[model samples]
Target: MKLSSFAVPILSASTAFALSKLPRPHRRAPIVHDVCGSLNSDLILNEVIDSLGRATVAGHIEVCLCLSDVVKFVESNIVAQEAVKLLGDHVKVEALISGMITGLPTGSHCSYPDHARALCTDSNPCDFECTDGYLAFPPEKPTSCKCPNHLMECDGKCGHFKECPSKAPPSRRGNEPQCAAGRTMCGIPGTSTGQPWKCVDVTTDPTTCGGCLNASPFGNAPVAGVNCEDIKGVIPGTVACGNGRCIVKDCAEGFFVAPASDACIPVPEYATVDSNQQSGEAIPGSAGSIEGPKVSRDELTAALKHGAGIAIAHFGGPVGGLKTPRDVTSGIQHGTGVLVKPVEGTSAGFKATRDVGLAHGAAKSLTAGHMGAFAGTHGIRGVDGGLIPGAGTCAKGV
Candidate 1:
């Protein structure tokens, strides 16, 4: 307390504390993680949004360039993840990157105003003048631009630009005039503008069969046109336009062209003979309309063939031998005999029969007789042996 050796040190420490408490010039804190910090992040994001707005107003190419710059900055700085998090959705980030990569202008000559001006200088000044049939682009670039009547340019050399080819037929360039050879300019119905017309080949265009069938180009009533490809029941790729008319070359399965008509009609189901030799035709009974179950021709054929085979096999061997050519021919008409018992002493007969039945069932018609014979042939003689009842009859039981 009496001015010892620590007295000067204590005075200096107090003075330093007082100075620390005094107000001083403010300084910003160092940014952490670069622009990932909230303040810097928002500032960069705002700058990007502003640039995008200006670029959009400028044109498509400008927007592309702006997006490309943003992408390059984010990637080069290793902050793509941070940018995506700030954007709040990876899809938006992906879309931005995609837009930057695709649909951008190509070639070296400049068309953008700012870029074109950068290429101009005192020594290599812009001509702002071009020969007849040619024009100065950008009014700043020194390059002389020329293109055909169908071409155009702002500040760079002109060239033809076409849309990607389509997969369908009648492939042609999108920039080509629709009213070229083999095509007619037909006005769209309900449209007043002459520019709303479409070009089509009325002679071969299936949709505009005969002429501008749906258009009233001359201000008259629209001509009705048939879309041949839209004809019901006509096989796809089988209908065509000929001489301005829809010509159906073929009808789809289960359909037929009615006599003296171009339309397709369903095939009529015919009546068949039932038990007691009665025709299976529909009739109006007291209760209601009575009709027999319809059988397809294919089904009937398969049933008859299956039944005839069983009958022949049962009778051909022991009941009566094939003594004449007619008997042989009749047996031949039917398919191979259905086996009632497996071949004796063969270990594989049961498995082989089962496999054959499965194969035939999938590849061709499998009837009750086939299943029953398959079981019985393998010496199976219980309920399983009669897998299907009425194994060898041609009636509905089959």
Candidate 2:
């Protein structure tokens, strides 16, 4: 299992100069791929595998940085320790950072509220009040806001601030809600837009809220209940506001952070079912409240676990005797890189991640970077091969 030739040429001119400056033994090593397993005589499969194999190897090589290199990489805008922690020790930390740094456009550096230690603190700076048990910001807080909730300062405006129902236009026979003057058709509870907003109408409108537009189901309704009121469930620790809203200062009796929204959720009672399965891994039910794929711990866990078998290592720098295989503490940014190597014997095995929902998205980009760094393949292209080997040429096996 000798290391292979260098997979892709180290591109950063500065990095190349730095590598040249390092002693011969410290220079970037070559990576080579060995095809000892089942060979695909089929040209298509062979071409695909051959093209993908180098990258597969590189993917495995990125996560084993020492605490020092890992910290430097984080400080250098190459990687985030928090993001790396989520990926855990099995993946390459330094190599992944190097690969990403090498591939970045000239003058590009990890930046903004997206990176670890963003200039902004997510801690809710505002004192939020649960008016009569409903979670809300003060009317002074713009009702329409896309900012991260729970952390951002909110002025505590809770409850239905809708125009008086008495002022609403007449209800039509066809189930269409007519709006009064100065109002337009809108989702109820008045979204950012000020028109007569569309209401979830949990009280009535089955198809709209829970079941029907007429009979209202407030508390216990089917999960599929169209009525907004019916769909929201009640838990013990939460304060129930009249109209339709619940304030949860803490997680439900059985849940933890849903991992997706970073919000509290119901923890599974079956934590013992599998060491792989644990609390705070699934996307909490709250995710469903919003549009788009809600980040869920369960889904994220599945993604993180799927790639665990890949072996990773830091190949260069003063890396000897340094700690490797660190945990990814937080989420990775959109284009963050991840290092990987093939599992010695098995193609797959148990995988773990700190936040499950984010695992899949982060894995994709990390794998992309792995493939690109090692095989000269595009990051997007590497995803097709799952956890294949990358360029380990002479140092490890191809």
**In candidate 2, how many clashes are counted?**
93
Q: What TM-score against the true fold does each predicted structure earn?
A: 0.24, 0.16
Lowest-scoring 10 consecutive residues by lDDT in candidate 2? 34-43
Model 1: which ten-residue window has the lowest total lDDT?
A: 31-40
Clashes by residue pair, model 1: 137-154, 137-155, 138-154, 138-155, 210-244, 213-223, 342-377
Q: Say which candidate scores most in TM-score.
A: 1
lDDT of 2 by residue, 1-398 (tens): 64445533444566789878875322222111111111111111111134447322212122322222334545443224443444453245444444443442431222111001211112321112222223222234312122222332222222344443323432333222232222223233423654323324333333343222332222222333333222223233343222222223335444443333223444333221222212323222232231112335454344333232212322222111112232432333332234432222232212334232232334432211222233222223323434223312111222
Q: What is the C-alpha lDDT of each candidate?
A: 0.39, 0.29
Clash count per candidate: 7, 93
Off by over 4 Å in 1: 1-182, 188-195, 216-222, 259-261, 269-398
Model number with the top lDDT = 1
lDDT of 1 by residue, 1-398 (tens): 37888788999999999999998544323211111100111113332455447322111121212222344544543344455666775555545544443433431222221111122222321212343234443133323223445754322233453432322322223222323346565667666653455766787888788777566343333466677777788887877787777777789875665443356655433211221123333222223222223444454344334332221122111112111222121222223333222222221122112212211221122221232333233222232332233234111111
